[model samples]
Target: MRLSRYFLPILRETPKEAEIVSHRLMLRAGLVRQQAAGIYSWLPLGQRVLSRIERIVREEQDRAGAVEILMPTIQPADLWRESGRYDDYGKEMLRIVDRHERDMLYGPTNEEMVTEIFRSYVSSYKALPLNLYHIQWKFRDEVRPRFGVMRGREFLMKDAYSFDIDEAAARISYNKMFVAYLRTFARMGLTAIPMRAETGPIGGDLSHEFLVLAETGESGVYCHKDVLDQPVPGEGFDYSGDLDAAIAPWTAYYAATEDVHDQERFEREVPEDKRLHTRGIEVGQVFYFGTKYSAPMKATVAGPDGVERPVHSGSYGVGVSRLAGAIIEASHDDDGIIWPDSVAPFAVGLINLKPVDEATSAAAEGIYERLTKAGIDVLYDDVDNRAGAKFATMDLIGLPWQVIVGPKGIASGEVEIKRRATGERETLTIDAAINRLVAG
Candidate 1:
């Protein structure tokens, strides 16, 4: 992608409505544009990062044995009524009516709908331990939606539902999601701490919320300091094996959000030096609600003994869109966002300091083609913009690697390579630069 032909509408000044750094930076960087109070239209650059995050979430879900299936954005209100939550869900639910006066709604969550789907064709225990997931947009009518996408009324989410025959099997499903969440956040260069959380309207006794610590977070959290430095399971971890032992290291610590906090117990358990109290953003939540929706909606399966039983179920959710803002909150500096390598919209950014110059343009064009053919997402800055403006835009968008081609450098038969995170720049021959980027 070349900046000369791209649609990056970077703001020269910060917007007054943006209250926090992440919100401001997102607007200044031209990643998202607000269409309404809390609804946004993702631009080209922002959409690329969003897609990358979605892919990571999907891959991790698949590794945990969850199958992918897309659900609709709009749903009939009868499904919510069947689950006994039509009125109980309150004003947060976006209730509507069709032309014929039938109750409809833009779904805030999919528990009732997923339960209805599960009971439709899955009748025998042979289909037990099934997990289904979807990446889709959801709507919730927040009374005060602010902080950009971090607390948007309309946002994208990756929600998964697991069905099992009994409580014991449901626990296994929960553990799979627990491990999957850890790996998913780790891929985005975040250390998310899993803490006991209130069930809220979701309604379940067993629930955990994964939070990423940030100075400007919405909720306060308390945990052990070791959790910040704990090692996440690596790529080769066997998802099929028993994850109980793998997760023990993380669960050994006492962690809780404000809703579930026990100050006295925290004081007794954690030493002063080991205690860590900070503000955190909730990025994911998992709930194992035994027969919560299944029984009410008649989502039953036949047991081995030939008895019909309500399948124990669990729901796992990751804030796919909110994570982009949360990540910026955790990783940005004074300049702009510092994207993680795995979730960077483009792997490499090639800047042509002198787009009109024959030598500089040729060098940048060659590098861009080489990087693209090598399977790297490269953004070439071929726009007729000043060097400072080009640098600022590239930093604001936060590509991991940047290659600068200027007349002076090209005259020496070399280009400058800079790492966005560390600001380390090195001058290398054109051949050597291409080799290094391809190898990475």
Candidate 2:
């Protein structure tokens, strides 16, 4: 993509309303624009990153044996009523009325609706252990929606619903999602610590929230430091095997959010040196709600003994849009968002330092074409802007690498390659630079 023809609206100054680092950086980088309190219009740049994050989520969910199926943003109010939560969900639920005067709502979550779908067609244990998921927009009218997308009124989410015949099978489904979440966050360059959490309105005895530690986080967390270093389950991990063993290393450490934190137990379980108490942002959560919604909504399947019973169920959710903001919070520096390689909108930013100079423009275009042809995403800044402004813009957007092509470098038969995470620069021949990035 050429910046000259792009739609980025980079802000010159930080917005006063942005209280957190991610919100401020997101505004300045022109990733998103607020249309109302907590409501945002994801601009082109933001959309790219959002799509990348959603793709990673989908990949992991599929790897864990969950099938994809999109659900509607608006739902019938009667579905929630059937689950006995129509009124109990409170003010956050955006209640609506249709032209026919029938009750409707912009769904905050999909438990009730998914249960209705399950009971409609799935009748017997033959379809047991089924998991369905979707990536879709959701809304909850927050009383005080702030901190940009972190606590937005409207956001994108990846929600997966798992159905099994009994408690034991439901636990297996839950464990699959647990391992999936760990791998998902790790792929995006985040070390997410899974901590025991309150099920809240979801009403589950078994629940875990995956949090990424950040000073500006909404909740305080206590965990063993080793939880941060535990390796994620690799790609070849057997999903059909005992997933408990795969997650044992992470669960061995005591971790809990403030809602469930036990100070005395934390101290007893972890040595002083191994204890880590800090603020953290929640990125995802998994729950085994048993028959919470299924029984109430009559979502039953026949057992092997021919007895009809409510199917045990679980819900797994990842804050798809909130993760963009969370990633910024966890990865940025003073400059701007330091996007992880997997979730970066572009792998490389090609800056034509002297867009007006024929040599520099030609060199940049050449490198951009080569990278793009090699199936790399590259953003070429071919606009007629000052070198400092170009550099600032590149750093603010935070692509993993910046390939600088100035007249001086071109004259010397070399180009400058700079790593965004570290301010390390290497001057190499154009061919060498291209080879290095391609090989990476």
How far out, in Å, is residue 43 in model 1? 0.2
lDDT tens digits, residues 223-297, model 2? 999888888999798899988899899899999999999999999999999999999999999999999999988
lDDT of 2 at 80: 90
Worst 10 residues of 1 by lDDT: 224-233
Q: Cα lDDT of model 2 overall?
A: 0.94
Q: Give candidate 2 regions above 4 Å deviation.
A: none
lDDT of 1 by residue, 391-417 (tens): 988888888899999999999999999
Q: At residue 40, what lDDT does model 1 achieve?
A: 97
Can you tell me which runs of candidate 1 are displaced by over 4 Å? none
List per-prediction Cα lDDT, in the order shown. 0.92, 0.94
